[model samples]
Target: MLSPVSTDSNHHPLNGTDATEHSVGADLPRAIATLNEEETYRALLTATHWATLDHAYGSAAEAPKRLAELLAQDQTVRTKALDYLHYTLHHQNTLYEATAPAALYVAAILPNPRTTRTVDKGHNSFPGCMRAELLLWIASVADAVTDEADVLSRRHGFPLDDYPPAVSIRRIRPQLYSAAVAYVDDTDRPTAEAAITACIRLLDDPRLLHHRAALVPGIRQILGTSEQWQHRERAIDALDTWGEDSTGLEGQQNPFLFCDSDTPTDNGSRPIDTNEGYSEPPPF
Candidate 1:
C-alpha cells in the first residue's frame, strides 16, 4: 500500500530535508514536448558521476549509456535499454543509489511522441505506449520508498529518510509527478491508466496530497474502463487511503488474466506482464 495519508491532510511535514514545496496555487505539469529532448539526454549523462553510485549489479556505470540508448532510432536498441532499467537500476523493485538519480532523467523524457506511438511487447491488440514503461519503472522506484518500504529498511537497519537513496528518491516526487500527471488524460487508454497509477503512488508523500483534489475525476474515468484490474485496484486503495470518495471505483473481480493480474505491481513485485511492459513486438 501507500504511506498512510497524513492524518491531517493539511499537515505537510516540511522538516529539514523532507521539505516539499507549498508554492503552487494551481498545479502545472511538464512534458517532453516542452523540452529539448536531445539536451535532456546529454544532461542526464553529465548531471552526475553515475559510476560513483551503485545499482543491483554493481557500479551504475552503464546507467547513463542505457538511458541514452532509450532514444535510439532502432527499436530493439531502445527496448533493450528499458529492459536494463527494469532488471538492474530498479531491479526487483529494489532501489539503488543510481535509481533515483536516473529516475529524474526518466521523468524528464515523458510524452516523447516516438514512445507514444510504440506498442509494448507481448500484446497483440492495443497495448500501451512505451511511456507506460517509463512511468511504471518510475513507479517501481517510488514504490520502493513508500511507508511499506520503510518497514524493509528498518529491518535492515535504517528508516527510509536516513537511507541516502531513499531520501534522494523522496526529494524528487514533484518532478516525477509532473511527468505522470500530464499524461492522465492521454488518448491511449492503457497509458492514461498507467499515468493514474503513477500519480497515486507518488502522492504517498504528504506534501503531494494537495494533488488528490485535482486527480479524482480523471482517475475515476480511467478506472471506470480499465481492464488492467490489478493496477485499477491499487489505484482505488490509494484513493480510499487519501480519504477520497471511491464510491463506484471498485476493481474488476479476481481470476484476472495473466498479464492483468501480474502487472501494475508494487514494492519488489515483477509482474509477469512487467517483462512485456516495455516494448512492443517488431513487425516483420
Candidate 2:
C-alpha cells in the first residue's frame, strides 16, 4: 500500500531546486489509488489529512471539509480520524500537539465526549483492544490544560477570586485540562485530584467504571478526608455506589474516600439537608 508522502519533503518545483519543503499539496495519486480498499484507505487518509489543514497550505477550511466528506461515507475513516485527533491533541511535540489557538475549531468540529464513547465501542476488534483508551486520552489532555492555567494564574499573580463566578467553569475547564492531560499516559499523584473529580462526574453514568479504575487514588482521597463525619460518609456512599471492589488503591483493598465532601451538621456525621445547613462543594 502507498504510505503518506511527506509533505515536509522537497517537491521538484517546476522552477528549480531551492523550493522550501512544506505541507502544501495536491492529492497524491497513491492516496487516490487506495481509496477503493476501504480500511487501508481510511487509515492512510486519516493519518495524512492534517496536511491539508496546515496554514502553509492555501485552503485552510477546505481540508477539514474534505475530511468531513470522507467521514460521512466511511465509518472506518471517522473512527481513525477521531483516534488520530486524540493522538495529536496529547502528543508532547510542539510541532504535532494541538494548540490552545485551535479551541474554536475543536469546539466546532470535535465529537461530543459522551457520543464519542459509543463510537469508540463500535471500533473494537478484541478484549485488549478496548475503546476506553481514546476517551481517557481526551480526558487527560483536558485536565492537563486546566492545570496549566491554574499554574499560570498562580505564577503570574492572577487571583482565583478574579475569575467570574457566573461563568460556567466546567465548560471551559475541561478543554484546558484535556490539553495538558492528553500528554500524560501514566497516572501521577498530583493529577489524582483532577482525575478523581473527572471520575466522579463520569460515575453518574455507570459505564465509566471500567475506565475510571485508573483514576482510583484521586477518588480515594476524596472519600477519605476527615472534614466531618457526614461528609466522610457521603464520600463513602459515592465509593459504595461504585461498589466495594470498585476501590483500587495501591495498598488498600477497601479504599477510604476522603473528607473533601464535608457535611456541616453538628457531628458532620449527619447529612446536611438544608441549603442553609451545608457549605457548597467547591466549583467542579
Candidate with maximal lDDT: 1
**lDDT tens digits, residues 1-284, model 2?**
11111122133111123323312212222223433444543443343334333222232333443334323435455555443333232222111112222221232222222222323222122211112333333344333324344567668886433433102222233332332233223233222322333334433322233544544444466434533343345445556656644343333233474422222222111122234433232122
Report lDDT (CA) for all predictions. 0.64, 0.33
* Model 1: worst 10 consecutive residues (lDDT sum): 4-13
Superposed on all Cα atoms, model 2 deviates from the true structure by an RMSD in Å of 19.6
TM-score of each: 0.76, 0.29
Which ranges of candidate 2 are over 4 A from the true structure? Answer: 1-63, 66-73, 87-90, 93-134, 146-171, 174-248, 251-284
Residue 162 lDDT, candidate 1, scale 0-100: 75
The TM-score of predicted model 2 comes to: 0.29
Point to the candidate with the largest TM-score.
1
Clashing residue pairs in all predictions, respectively, total 5, 28
